[model samples]
Target chain A: MNIKIVKTDGDVEGLAEQKWVYSPSVKTHFFHPENLVEDVNGFDDSDYNGVGAVGSPACGDMMKMWIKVDPKSDKVVDCKWQTFGCASAIASTSMLSVMVTENGGMKVDDALALKPQNILERLGGLPPRKVHCSVLGDKALRKAINEYFRHSKQFDRMVIEGSVMVDPDTRITDRDIEEAVLEGADDMDKLQKKLKVGIANKDAYAKAEALMGKFMEKYYG
Target chain B: MKISSQVNKLLKDHKKHDIYLDHAATTPMDPAVKAAMDPYFCDKFGNPSGFYEIGLRAHEALEEARNKVAKILNCSSREIVFCGSGTESDNLAILGVARFKGKGHIITSSIEHHAVLETIERLEKQGFDITILPVDRDGFVNPKDLDDAIREDTILASIMYANNEIGVIEPIKELATVCRNKGVLFHTDACQAGCSLDLDVKELGVDLMTINGSKIYGPKGVGCLYVKAGIRLEPIVYGGGQERGLRSGTENVPGVIGFAKALTLCQDDKDKENKRLTQLRDKLIKGLITKVPKCFLNGHAVKRLPNNVNITILDVEGEAMGLFLNELGIYASTGSACTSKSLDPSHVITALGLPYEAAHGSMRFTLGHCTTPEDIDFVIEVMPKIVEILRKISPLDLDSNEVQEGHGNLHYK
Candidate 1:
């Protein structure tokens, strides 16, 4: 009258199997998002040191991050986020929130140093197609750091401007070259026409083209 | 002894408890069809082209299967040409006819399966003029639009019987008649519709129709193209001059037998089963809309397939929902499996004029003969919790006025 169900090692594995098309760490964070601000009203107040948002619903992925910083120590006191995206995006942002707030919070500068690879590594890994999802979290965090500087009137602390260079004479930037390639300018000549790169300095044009080739491999690959 | 025990353990643990709802993607083979195909694999195995008695038997079995399919389709047996799969049948019909005519115009809908759409795209690259007709809000193509788009050089028009994503059935008879009046050969990919609807090819007035085995509980890798008599088609894959030189490959006897048996079994009880599936479909649709707020049904209310229930739950990614449902042993699809991994949203959902968010949030749950009312109840019971969890973490919750305002500004910036 007693039904004895066998429980083997395989059965245990089946029970603990990952269900999502994501790594185990991603599935963990997606289902149990750490420091996820469930209520927008809770974080939309003036107490938040900075708020950063990236992506758009129209683009099928969006993220918003809020950080509370301790003024005395210049460290993040709490970090929270909300995201509308696939499992990878939600998990990436969730891990970002936890990473920033863990261990008594990262220093404002240290949290800004966090990269997409750091978040991705914490979440094990993402599908190649979904690695872009991890980028949103780091981008949003950097935006929050910039917002903090802008609000605190510490414009000199911003470091992103230094990486984005535009030749003063030619008036072209790495961003311009990247945008040109993304907008269907494939070859060097097409990029030259689109950005007018060699008009002033021919050496700068060669440098810009080489830089764009590297960016293409990094982004397109 | 150790390996044997391990094998036993693995076998016992691998027992499936899933309540499959992705029947539109494919179906498990019916037992009757499997039984019919068993002999062909061994005892009766023979190349239909061989000159011996065994070969003649296989040839006869192949002909019998063709006749069974033709009977259900209300077409002559000679018009039926067996092929590998629905995709292959579609490729043969589109590419075959287009290549035979050398160069001309082709018309298809924005919602056609990739088999037809991609084929037409390739044809376009080869100097053939192509026009992709748009669908209405309910994913139905307008007959008037087809009539207006027909040109003097229009050689062929391919439309789907029912959309695989939204499940809305097109007005095939009317659309085909429009093409007929304009001297255009019309083709319909009826792979999704063969089991759920009456597919009398003569009544539908399609010059060419595509039907597959796996969609109707037969084995995969077998389907047929119903080419109306006297329609010229060049061979896409030339080999043994099988299928009367139109298909030209060694006949797949076992797959053909299974397909025929499956089609007969499906046609025999389709009316009663369709009624059951429609009731279950309605219950699931109604339960989801009532339980899950900010959710709406996709596709037409009554013009869709009886087995199909597609819905869009706002502010949640369909892939996330699908994964959650999978944990509860409910297998479903967010969109066409072929395009699910791609970054681009479903073209079929987007073609219905839905906004980007709604299209990104669509899920399709197609029912079948094995689907039951209890399964529907289980899905209804669990779906709301999943939706609530997803929406809680979602950045955009339109129900909250403050969140909507915040999201609007963020979007604008």
Candidate 2:
């Protein structure tokens, strides 16, 4: 037997299957994530028709995606993305990009219907605590689809996912809380800084604060 | 799944992970320590509790190992309680003491190992008032803070000698003095500090201390807790009434022998190893800070362990950096939640009051016996490139949020 030091088993390939902690599929996407926009600043957005983003870097997770839609059939032709997130988030986003554009692309509505559960299932599974990461990709995809609807003058198709309006005046919706939470507004004070919902109207502020709690629990719980 | 099996095989076949930088997690057993333990598994297999000749020999060996460890610790042989592992020792020290008292106020730092923190947490559920003192930016638990937190009902203060994550050594003697003045017991988990620091329990003034074998090039699954003479602790384990009735089980004779040998070796070579490891550690820290942009060290500059270098490189995730580093055969650890099952960033890094985001990019490299100057250089040269790649791939706007105010930035102290 070798004396003092044992070599770290050279099983770099085995890092994919972390037994119960991570499945092989989750690791595959993490180690070799697909459609990664290498430089978001330098990305050529001229080819893309729709752009959407969710979460924030300050929250320790953020994702932005761009998709080109085939207007004739409303099919997503190409997708590119970038993220500041963890293994689960990164892997989910990478798989999301593949899901939208593979086999000549998923229809725009079909892509919008995709959920965190689908992503979680595709990745085999994430640890129960890390289920939040799987939500990043689906949320960003929803944002992109909405952006496409707004741009192409299909106002009827633009829908915010199950969100109620926080302030009908400033047009601050409960959706704003998710974005604000993503942008690092963890508490009411930070939320006030970002959305400024409670400054002029006490009623609006109270509504905003309650919504912020709801969103924080939803995103972080 | 463009994850081509061909590509994975090609990558695996070409790489050799010869570097061993994550010593804070565990260390390889020394050959001498292993050789000394070989006979105990077979030839000296008799139970130390038996009355036969072979049993008597085993009993003598057990006492000899105890004396050797106690001599280094500057404590009596009867004070040392051998247990299964560092976690088990921590459980014995904190739970053993707490369960004896039934229920009372307890004080501990936010940076303690889960073995201490979790045990205390469980105690809290049983109706104990718990105070978790916060640390400063460089992860220092102020002695005055410990002094302030002590109460009339405070039974014990269980703080670590050095943190496993950042290698920041706490003010143990000062903290111990506060507990002594307040008539409360003190325990320190010195698992990470044992190899590099002085283990003289008298000088440190700690009432109890825990040390582990896996961290000191001995066999894993063996740890010792120094319980001051005349101090009472209830047994957490119950069986054959080994370890002075404070522990009950058939003793792990080989593990104890290996642990004593490793502790003796550490005592003999500590100064020289510390000097050599310190040079390498500083070089890696300095080199990474120079090579990478907007990165800062996580712990006290001079008061940290000689072998630990924990830094947070801006604009990247630590797990991504770890995978890239692995590709080059360098194994280190990161504080990124992506790498953990809990999905929460390191509580120690978070306790330093770093923005939650700062915890995502933190990487820890703990040097050990197998590490050479060349390994440090290789990391210094390669780590920055990996960070650069991750930063470019990341979606956050570099300017607006790269140095964004608040959260976890500006942690250098």
**Highest TM-score among the candidates is held by which one?**
1
lDDT of 1 at B303: 92
Docking class of 2: acceptable
Per-residue C-alpha lDDT of model 1 across residues B21-98, encoded as one tens digit per residue:
998999888888999999999899999998899999999999999999999999999999999999999999999999
What value of lDDT does candidate 2 attain over all alpha carbons? Answer: 0.81
The TM-scores, one per candidate, come to: 0.86, 0.85
Lowest-scoring 10 consecutive residues by lDDT in candidate 2 chain B? B404-413
Candidate 2 local lDDT, B196-290, one digit each (tens): 99999999999989999999999999999999998989989998899999788888999999999999998799999999999999999999999
Candidate 1 second chain TM: 0.92
Weakest 10 consecutive residues of candidate 1 chain A by summed lDDT: A1-10
lDDT per residue as tens, model 2, A126-214: 77656666666776777777888888989988885576766543345677677879877888766654443443346877988887787
Record all residue pairs in model 1 with backbone atoms less than 3 Å apart, i.e. clashing: none
Q: Show the colliding residue pairs in model 2.
A: B355-B407, B355-B408
TM-score of chain A of each: 0.68, 0.68
At residue B13, give the lDDT of candidate 1.
44
True contacts kept of 1: 0.44
Stretches of candidate 1 exceeding 4 Å from the true structure: A1-20, A43-45, A159-221, B1-17, B336-339, B399-413
Per-prediction DockQ: 0.25, 0.26
* Cα misplacement distance, residue B260 of candidate 2 (Å): 0.3
